[model samples]
Target: MAILLAPMEGLLDFVLRDILTRVGGVDRCVSEFIRVSNTLLPDQVFIRVVPELLNGGRTFAGVPVAAQLLGSDPVCLAENAARLAALGPHGIDLNFGCPAKTVNRHGGGAALLDEPELLLAIVAAVRRAVPKTMPVSAKMRLGVHDDSRALECALALEGGGASELVVHARTRADAYRPPAYWERIADIRAVVNIPVVANGEIWNVQDALRCREESGCDSLMLGRGMVTNPGLALAIRAAMAGPDASPAPWGNVRPDSSLTTSPALYPIINWQVLLPFIAEFWRLVCARLDRRKQAGRLKQWLNFLRHHHPEAERAYMALRTLSEPAAIGQWLALQ
Candidate 1:
């Protein structure tokens, strides 16, 4: 029951990866996609995208991290993948599932699904460029608009020497919509002999179990579910480990001895654990963008957290009114 953390662009940064890896049950982490183009990427670009490699290709806590690349050009992507492999990461994952209009417009992400042969070329080029021992994998949606060509796409990747494949159970058109067609993933599993990881709509332990049952996949990848419930990986692990096994609640403190035993306590505790990470994230964003831009990014994450974690609302309100990081830290402390 391997659980790989999905590489969500803006949400899953180094800070969050560090936090989640320390929480137990996650088998591996994939860094957000590094967009490649015609130009050679600067070393700093690799450093920023996969800083974990600085400390042995693992998160600060030693969880293995893989570098993921996104691009449409075979030559450019292969060159970048070779350079990244030289950096000594645990693995290299290619992204062909992103649905962003800008990415697709450039023929980078899911847009490649429209040309399965090109996708195969890119994977083959990358596999040839990287070391034979270094694992090469890919993640993709069923297709650009339908699952009709999914088998062809999976077979193409497999034919190109991809060590494994992760199938997000929806077409690019479905984008994060309801009822992910796990059956489509099962279809892909049947056609490919390599490891197939089922991904999509897995928001809880039950969902994870049902996904594996329906997709007949031995592994799984989690994205938005982890954003809403940080403990989801642990829950899935406990469920898969044994029916009698129960995971300890978050916060590292016993529930009975917690300062507040209220049913709502978990959300608050989650916020406490998350605040420092969020603050660090804001600082990193500020270093790369303007203050207004950084605040907008922070607000966006807080809004997502608000849906499942009550403290997110309070934290968002307090941070929305403050421009300085110190003030935000103070407000978080007071919570």
Candidate 2:
């Protein structure tokens, strides 16, 4: 079973990808979506979004990274995908699942689900542009407002030569509400011949088992869950494997444990144990981002980390007011 890191735009950039994959159990990662519009994007754009492309499309930990493109225009997507492929990305992924209002307003993301024909045309065009041996994939929600055309969207993407499909298991209208309809993914899997990866609301090993059973898919793509609990991927990987497989050291979890953690009872990871992760993130951001932007990136990570550790919230509060990256770095060190 493959476990992929979802391409969360403005988050999950190469620095986070490096950290997560180093924690172990991530097989592939899709880079944050590169927006394609009327013009073909420059090589630097791809490099900026997916520096893994420069490292042979693999993180330092050796996990492959796929270049994801988001756009409504088929030709532009194809052009960009071709250029990205030239840089040796491990694969190409078409993004039709972004729920941001700004993106959908531009005829990209989930909005394309309304026009299955156009979506398929864009996928087919990119598929044709990339090397025949390279893998091309697509990620989509159930539908725009409802799941009426969900199967059609899945089939259209598959027919357009998508080697695999990742379904987020919600309609555009449902946008992140509770109770992802994983069963819908099973219905889509029943008809499509390519690998179907189930995504959305998988928070633990039990959740993974239930999602797999309900969606009838072995592969999965994890997003927020990975951030909330950085060790989730490793924990789930251990659970799914035979007893002989190595045990995950970070989180000691078993099937009998609750499937999800309430915020009140969320495990408060010790500040000391988490310090290294925070430090590494700060270091990497310092290397990749401008000095002015580093503090914002640190805040972004703390925003996600706070969900698991309340101390992170306290740290965020301390650093939130700090503007200088060096000051933030010093603050993290003092912790």
Candidate 3:
């Protein structure tokens, strides 16, 4: 069974992938969707979104990372996939699951699910363009406005030569609402010959188990759940190890003073362990972004963190007023 980290746009960047993968238990990481329109994007664009491509398409911990592309044009997506494959990504993933208004307005993402033929055409074109050795995968919601043709879309992707399929388990109209309908993944799995990965509403080990049981799928793709708890992957790994296994004791682990590699192996720690990471993230992000932009990213991360960690709310409260990354770092240091 594989555990994949979802390519959440505007979040989950290279730095986050590096940090999360280093903690262990992720089989592969999918980069945030690279928006491809009518033209083929430049090499630098793909690299900027998936720097691991330059490092044999693997994170520092040696977990493979696939490059994901989002678009509606079959020829353009195929052209971009070929370009990305030439650069040697571990795999290629097509995105038909994004529900962002702007993306839908432009006929990209979940909008394509409304027209299964176009989705199949886009995937088939890209599959033909890339080397057979490279795995071509597709991600989709249950359907566009409903699940009426959910089975049809999954079959289309499979027929189009997608090596694997990832179902987010919600229709385009559902859009990140309550009740992810993980069981719906079984519907896709029932008809498809390829491996079906279940995604959505999996927040912890118990949720992972339930998702596996309900979806009847061994593999899973995690998105917002990962943002809520960085140690979630390791926890799920432990749970899968044996019936007697349990989550790691984070409180017992020593402080990661270097703020780089942890002294322990795949250590699972409490939310408090995230302090050094928060500081390091601010430092690294600040080096690459302006003050306001860095602050925005910090707030965005904290916003997700608040869902799982109480301390994150206090941190967000204190740091929300500060727009400077240095100030955020200093606040973390004081904490």
Candidate 4:
């Protein structure tokens, strides 16, 4: 079974991709969505999103990476898709799963789900633009407001020549809520001959197994689960390999000295391992963003990590008080 790392915008950048791929089991990685507008993106924009292409379309550690495009215009997207394909990525992926209000308001991301014909036109245009040998895939939510429209969209994408589909198992309205409807993925799989990859709410090994069983999908895609627990992909890979494979130890690894215990005193130690990584992550993010935007981005990740790690709250509290990345780095250095 193929285990793919989902393309989560700011949270899953090159550094995270490098770290997760090095943990040893992901089949492939997708770069965060490149929002396409009027003109084709310059080579540098593609490089910023998929620097792996600089090293032969592979991550720093050599894991394959695909370039993902997000746009509402069929012709513009097709042009950019063709340009990105020339970069020699393993494949090209279309994004119809992002639920951010801004992206949706602009008629990109999951908003496209509302118009099956438009989605089909975009995918077909992109597929026709790329080389016949190159594979074009798509990732999408069940629908915009309800699962009522999922089948039509899935069928439209397949009919448009999508080689594979990754279903997030929730509508754009669900927005990361509980109960990711894996059964909906099965529904899509039943209608399409293309491979279906089940995504969303897969937080652990058992969840991965159950999702595959319930959805009857041959592969899985992971998002927030990978952020809270770095070794999750490794664990899932081990589980798929055989029952005899051992799961990686959780909450025992620490990248910061400030973390006092293997499992910190707080109740959510399992999630604390992510704090150091997040700190380092935003340090890199800060290089590209202004102060306020960087803080907002850091807080967004910390909020997600807080659900699983005790240190995350503490780190968030401490980090929130600092206005500069240097202070955050200093706090981490002391840790």
Per-candidate TM-scores read 0.87, 0.90, 0.91, 0.83
Model 1 spans > 4 angstroms off? 246-298
Looking at model 1, residue 294 earns an lDDT score of 62
Error of 4 at 218 (Å): 2.6
For model 2, the stretches where C-alpha displacement exceeds 4 angstroms are 242-271
Better of 1 and 4 by lDDT: 4
lDDT of 3 by residue, 1-335 (tens): 88999988888988778766765667888999999988978999999989898899988777899999999889999999999999999999999999999999999999988898998899899999999999999999998898988999999999999999999999889998978898889988999999999999899889999999999999999888888787787677767776554434454333222212222234454666777677767776778665667889889889998988888999889988898666777787887
Question: Clash number for model 1?
Answer: 0
Residue-level lDDT tens digits of model 2 in 146-240: 99999999999998999999999998889989789999999999899999999999987789999999999999999998877776776676666
In TM-score terms, candidate 3 sits at 0.91
Query: In model 4, which runs have C-alpha deviations exceeding 4 angstroms?
Result: 246-303
Compose the digit string of candidate 1's lDDT tens values, residues 1-335: 68898899877876567655654457788899999989779777987878888888987556789999999899999998999899989999999999899999988888899888998999999999999999999999999988889999999999888999999999899999989999889888887889999999998878999999999998999988887776677667666656554335565533112211122212223656655555655656667556666666677778777877887887778787677756665665565
Candidate 4 per-residue lDDT, tens place, 48-135, comes to 8888888999865567898999999999999999989999998999999999999999999999998999989999999999999999
* lDDT for each candidate structure: 0.80, 0.85, 0.85, 0.81
Clashing pairs in 2: none
Lowest-sum lDDT 10-residue window in model 3 = 255-264
TM-score rank order: 3, 2, 1, 4
Q: What is the model-wide C-alpha lDDT for candidate 2?
A: 0.85
Q: Which stretches of candidate 3 lie over 4 Å from their true place?
A: 243-268
TM-score of 2: 0.90
By TM-score, the best candidate is 3
